[model samples]
Target: MSSYLIRNAQILGGAPQDILVDGGVIQQIGPGPTVEADIDIDATGLILLPGLVDLHTHLREPGKEDAETVLTGTQAAAKGGFTAVHAMANTTPVADNATVVEQVWQLGRDSGYCDVHPVGAVTVGLEGKELAELAAMHGSAAGVRVFSDDGKCVDDAVLMRAALEFAKSVDGVVAQHAQEPRLTEGAQMNEGTVSAELGLGGWPAVAEEAIIARDVLLAGHLGARLHVCHLSTVGSVRIVRWAKSQGWDVTAEVTPHHLLLTDEMVRSGDPVFKVNPPLRTETDVLALREALADGTIDAVATDHAPHPDADKDCAWAVAAMGMVGLETALSVVQQTMVDTGLMNWEGVADRMSHRPARIGRLTGQGRPIAVGEPANLVLFDPAHRSVVDAATFATRSRNTPFRGLELPGRVHATFLRGMPTVLAGELVDQGDLS
Candidate 1:
């Protein structure tokens, strides 16, 4: 069996320690060497973290390979310190069935970079009409346990309730996109001072809040698990907090953009800022930061939607609603959360890795970085700073909003199951894509 040793790395940015990996599991972790290893990594200045888990990511494959394929997306994920990411089911054919989900899963295995858990669609082709084959997907090789109508919402209450009911039978989570169709129709930016001045149709905060309220109630009534994706509004946070106070099984995530940006950027008319669940006010940003700090938001998901230039490089009204995030998620989180003293690195691990894995029902991920745990971890340099350059990304698409912006920290290396997928702040070659 292959073996490796990480010497003198900080455990969650703490004091230095040594970690040994063998047979795809952590053999020992201590202040000194426990066993000899074939590969030695000098992690003298690295902060060891459990490999990140993103509950929401768009790997536009099976149709839009020009934007992002499973291999390229996983390459981006490994560079971002993620050992596993839940691929959103918003492809051309849609991953509502077992076949597509298994294809994506096998692609991840072939890539050998990160574990890609497929989120089966909550509706057929995301039509929001009839339910998809959730049970069959759950039993597929992919073992899909998370379902979402991500780009769209399940607007019908009856259908929503039914989806949640069926989800429980298979121990699955229904991640609602949480946008009221009527409320957000023709939406451009947030319904606020900026968007009003810009003369674009506003995406009202109530649109998101109303759906979250309905879904949480349905999940509570049905005793099913519900996850709110890319939660944007302050009202949404309040509702999630209230639902959790009521002991409802509702968890929410804040995207990297939502945590650090506001809709005021929309004034620039840049399509890169025109993400769905449009960025809200600075007030909303602060509220999201507080909610995430206090655990009102269960995790920090990338919502790493990728799109080709032809789709994104156009007028705001015609452009796609997404930004490539897989490469910059950790840095953005570090800047907005850790350096700001809103959260510690340990808290970052829980929000980015542990809790997300638990929410997605991913058994092989989010385990504690201890002896006998799967050797899935990332070595991050909290002190390193670099300018964002989309040209350097492993992802095929260069839709990153952080381009030309300086970001703090970097992922120096990543290990998945005792194997190196990235090293020296670069991807470790696993052969070739073609």
Candidate 2:
């Protein structure tokens, strides 16, 4: 059986202890004896977390391999300390059915970097018209538990309600992109002083907030799970908080970009900063931080949308709306949430790993750092700070807005099932043999 000894790692940022993994399970925890092992890591001074899990990652495969593939995207996830990532359903020919999702799932299994759970589409072709065969996708080998049209919203109230009801039967979550198409017509950046000064069309906060309000009510009424993706504005947070206060089955996620960046960054006219649910104001950023720390926001998903250089290098008006995020997610969170004192390492683990896994219904992922649990884990160096370099990313695309920015924290190593996918901050394919 494969075995590993993680020596002197601080579990959940607590006291240092040795952890032993045998045959993909945590066989022992505590001051374990140092002995022969198939793999051993000198993890002294490194903070160990349950392997991070991202509920929203766009792998862009099966058609957009020019941007990203299951292999490269999972490589980015592994670099970010994520053991699992939910591949969004917006691929070319869209992952709206079991066949497409299974293909993505099988690709991830073959990659051997991170476990990729494919998010099936909520509608047939994401057209907001006919509903996709949600049950078929869920029951397929992919075992898709989350359904979303993500790049588009299910604006038809009838369709939204029907999706909620249908999801109830199979216990699936319907995650929404939450943009009101009418409200965001021709929108370019966040609707505010910056957009006015820059003479660019604006995406209003109300556009996102209105949908969250409607969908949370729909989800509550139907008694099904609703997940709000990449929540950006203050108004959206308020709606999510109210839904939670009422004990409705609704959860919200804020991306790393929204938590740290403001719409003002668009003033530079750099297409790299452009993203859907356009980055909001400083006030919104602070509120998002508070909401996440207080549990009003459930998780931090890296809306890891990777676009090739040609797509993102165009003029602002025509540039694609996304930024590659997986490799930088943990660093941004460490800088914005932990270093700012809004949350501790344990809180980061909960938001980044535990809650996301639970939301996606991933049994093997997001397990606790304890005995008898799956040995998916990350060893992070909080003291490590490095400059952001898109050129060095594992992703095929380099549309990151964080380029040239210095960020704190680093993933020293990431282990998936007692095998290292990344060791000493570099990728290795040896884990496939395990």
Q: What is the TM-score of each candidate against the true structure?
A: 0.98, 0.98
lDDT of each: 0.92, 0.92
Residue pair clashes in candidate 2: none
Taking the tens digit of each residue's C-alpha lDDT, what string does model 2 give over 308-360? 88888889999999988999999999999989999999999999999999898
User: Candidate 1: where is the Cα deviation over 4 Å?
Assistant: 432-434
TM value for model 2: 0.98
Instruction: Provide the lDDT at 394 for model 2.
Output: 94
* Candidate 2, residue 283: how far the Cα is off, in Å: 0.3
TM-score of 1: 0.98
lDDT of 1 at 384: 97
Error of 1 at 30 (Å): 1.1
